[model samples]
Target: MGKIIISENVTLDGVVEDPTGDEGSVSWFTRIGDADRAAWAEVEHEEAVGAAALLMGRRTHAYFLHRGWASRTDEWADRLRALPKYVVSSSAVADAGWGEATVLAGDVVKEVAKLKEEVTGEIVVYGSGKLVPALLEHDLADELRLMIYPFVVGTGARLFPETSAVKPARLIGARPVGTALALLTYELVHP
Candidate 1:
């Protein structure tokens, strides 16, 4: 069965809203060098290549599709573009401009469960802030692989919601990708 893996770049304070600093997002990652960037890219490539498919929230899907990856000629970019992308949204997607991307076949939870039954690899989730909450709510997420930068954002949408319910997760592994980046892996546990 496929494992639902949530992969994201977050701040030390758990903010996943915007890491690219498009709207003054606080992140020390802007100081990363070529070596560190390349190291991170290699990790991303491995994960992307291993996944059976990608699940993205509508907003993330729209933003990314608008960016247009088809013009990129790099091997890693090619691999990323070729992977089947399932956008999770209630409304119909007008068009998935990104290569090989489509609106999920059915309801998010049901379709995700169906995907797990049909595939034996990982079902990777990327940049889906809104979808992550649903995954947690429906007990669908299996693993979390967050690349946390060594900085704090005072405000923004956090990966985890601020509700009273306490979700339990265990640290599975940690990899330091650069001078300040921590690739933290966690497994969600039901109690």
Candidate 2:
């Protein structure tokens, strides 16, 4: 019932690995000021309010959700903590710590399809690189939202991978997030 929404921050080259140079992507993301962070926080709040559930890969669960959102006291953090989460993982994690979560350690793609049949509203997937490939390949993801940054990372992991099947996306909306970010919403035009 719920649509799987793939949302991420990407450079012009579609690199979503790590915007901050400490990890391996671009370095400009670190230079943004309070206004930029505030703008991004607003977007997070809006998305959290609209999202019905959280779906992500293991790395996203460990690095982003656990290390990031779980420690916050904000409304968006509250929403994320309260929402039901489905993590696509190869190994079972008994303590994901982020209340109401399930690890789909077996056949992630198939399990996610089943999850889609069970839930309603928007199931947003954050930075889940490994799981995203399967979702895109299987045509399970319904919507794709890219928070396109100002620059490009010439050599890094890209958002769009090599695929034999054509994945068409029709641009539904585009808006600026402060001076540094451009939010682009696209509906996955599947055949």
lDDT winner: 2
Q: What would the TM-scores of all predictions be?
A: 0.88, 0.93
lDDT of 1: 0.80
Worst 10 residues of 2 by lDDT: 92-101
Give the Å error, residue 184, model 2: 0.4
RMSD list, candidates in order: 2.2, 1.6
Off by over 4 Å in 2: 94-96
Clashes of 2: 0
For candidate 1, lDDT tens digit of each residue in 48-118? 88888888888887777666665567777787777877888777664544575667757778987787787
lDDT of 2 by residue, 113-145 (tens): 999999999999998888888899999999999
Q: What is the lDDT of candidate 2?
A: 0.84
lDDT of model 2 at position 1: 99
